[model samples]
Target: MGTFITCAVTGGADTVSRHPRIPVTPKEIADAAISAAKAGAAIVHLHARDPKTGQQSRDPELFTEIVSLIRDSDTDVIINVSCGMAGDLILTDTPETQPAGAGTDLLGPRGRLQHLDRLCRDPRLKPEICTLDCGSMNFGDGDLVYLAPATYLRPMAQHIRSLGIKPELEVFELGHLAFVQKMSAEGLLDGAPLIQFCLGIPGGAPAEPFILDAFKQLAPTGSVWSAFAIGRDELRFVSLAAGQGGNVRVGLEDNLYLEKGVFADNDTLVERAVGLIRGMGGSVMNAADTRQKLGLDRAH
Candidate 1:
């Protein structure tokens, strides 16, 4: 099958101020996703934010509204909401006083999946795929961490599978990939598991070609995989991923620039990726073809 693109429209990053137009409101995010689909993205990976404050939120209603907006539209882009929220753990100098500091938004598995649960009540609003962060890691500099231990992840994966949603295994490093393999061995994942190699984060694996080659080699056989790198390396990895016979992802979530000193929106990033893929002599798969390739259920 040909390569497909997944556009991560807006994330929990502090990019709203960095760029002129970051999709913060539910309508804006939905519009960005739809526009990206029109620009040749097969899937639109999404996250919800507070409309007024432009801050990150895990509120199920916000997600429901966003999904509703997208589904109501004519676009048939595959929806993939993040289950990676509410997992941040910030440390304090006085460990006893503040184990999880002010920035921390840590929650157990159920709280993390609440948004997906809310959307699942209506088949039409249910996302075709949701993310499952394979393991925990130090997110960036400072004491902040992205906490997703195996104990929490196992149950989260089970719940995601039970909901009839494909879990995109997001791995930041080799250890995370190992945990994913362990889950697959325990019969937690269904069908050919979808994996996403997330590289070039401050505390994660470097976004180097050799690193991607290693990840591709270690990944489970027959698993459908895609990859992305944050910031400047985002576009570079698009070509690298496509050239290596895998899928590609691009959007303002992971990058804010179409080029140096040039701010970008979701649609432009997807369009640039489409150009890169076609430039590499690769066929860009549409949403229907990607659904078939990934075995996504579209009964809704």
Candidate 2:
């Protein structure tokens, strides 16, 4: 199992306030992605933000501009736009009120896939792959939930399949993996399923070696798996995952620091991950190799 490294350039959430180097505009994102690709990342997991306020945006225009910029560049990195953006819900309560203050939230699967349809419909901007968060969880911060019931996931899987885009099943916990396997058994996910193990998020799987090993054992048979850890456990899990015959993911989207109190940029993260993989006698797969390995058809 050769290692394939993916750099999550910018997530469509509130990381800008935490990291000064998080790219906000399409130009910045495109540049960061290209830099990561040049360093070692084969796939660039992308999420767009509002240029002015740095708020997450699922608007097709923003996604289109970002994808186009990268496609026009010399970088040949495979693009993976996040379909994980639209399902977030944030609710705030008023101090004096019983219910709460004004917050944010979105309901239903159709609402979540609205942005996905826009991206998939644009022939010039179609991503070769998009994420399918298998199960709902309490996304860190505030009283919010990232909802993805089986009813929602089944249809979303069908929709992504119809679009000819590979769905990267993101499993944050053991049960999430089970759900993905069930979906695969149901003929929703095509080919050998691609699974991403997300570790060390609040309310999700903790960043423990044993936990990762358990999850690895639970991964769908014949599925391709990649692993990532957030915050302090980033590099530790990178080495562990690569050593354990799984690919690796590392970026500011998961961890803002390269070292204690040391802020790192996206390219630096990619470079470090590549170094670790190579140091461990693992070869990093290129975009073409990754596409072939993951059974993905190139986007024209």
> Using Cα atoms with residue i matched to residue i, what is each candidate's TM-score against the true structure?
0.99, 0.94
Candidate 2 residue lDDT tens string, 1-300: 479998998886588889888999999999999999999999999988999999888777888888889988857788887888656565556545543323455556666667668877767678888889999899776677777889889988898888888999999989999998799889998899989999999989999999989988988799899999998899999999999999999888888999999999989999999989899888999998998898877756
Best by TM-score: 1
Estimate candidate 2's alpha-carbon lDDT, on a 0 to 1 scale: 0.86
Best by lDDT: 1
Return the lDDT, model 1, position 142: 86
Candidate 1 lDDT trough over 10 residues, lowest sum: 97-106
Task: Work out candidate 2's RMSD over C-alphas.
Answer: 2.1
Off by over 4 Å in 2: 91-101
**lDDT scores in order:** 0.93, 0.86
Q: Compared with the true structure, what per-residue lDDT tens digits does model 1 show for residues 220-244?
A: 8889999999999999999999999
lDDT score of residue 90 within candidate 1: 86
Candidate 1: RMSD over Cα atoms?
Answer: 0.8
